[model samples]
Target: MNGPTILLVDEPTSALDHERGAAIIELITALTHERATATILVTHDRTHLTAADQIVEIHDGRLHLPAPAC
Candidate 1:
């Protein structure tokens, strides 16, 4: 691919508590943006998506892309 480097993270905070989980996602999102890395974070917790540029979700076996800009 000729796009920016993309990192795919699946459920990076499924096991941790709410606080720690938010921290982890925040860190990943911050680093990704600071380095211009295109990150694809697959998460179920919508609250932890503060750092994402756009949020995409899979619903009914399809991709939903109504996420707001960051």
Candidate 2:
């Protein structure tokens, strides 16, 4: 794979089924870790965000970040 410092993915799994979507997420996660690449995943589906290191949401043209875990 080409060495990239960052990867931006937009709705990569939107057209896929649940299983395929999961596989894509896993692949992205693995690549992010293995390559030490920063990944930006934009998706409407909130089901698979567990793989993210940080999660943010945009609402009413505002950016909202979640509170850190206790």
TM-scores for all candidates? 0.78, 0.91
TM-score of 1: 0.78
Q: What is the per-residue lDDT of model 1 for residues 1-70, given as tens digits with 9 covering 90 to 100?
A: 5456888899999999999998898799787877787888888877777777777778999988895559
Candidate with best TM-score: 2
Query: Which lDDT tens digits does candidate 2 get at residues 1-70?
Result: 4899999999999999999999999999999999999999999999899989999999999999898889
Give each model's whole-structure lDDT: 0.82, 0.94
Could you report the Cα RMSD, in angstroms, for every candidate shown? 4.1, 1.5
Error of 1 at 27 (Å): 1.1
TM-score, candidate 2, is 0.91
- Cα lDDT for residue 52, candidate 2: 93
Poorly placed runs, candidate 1 (over 4 Å):
1-4, 67-70
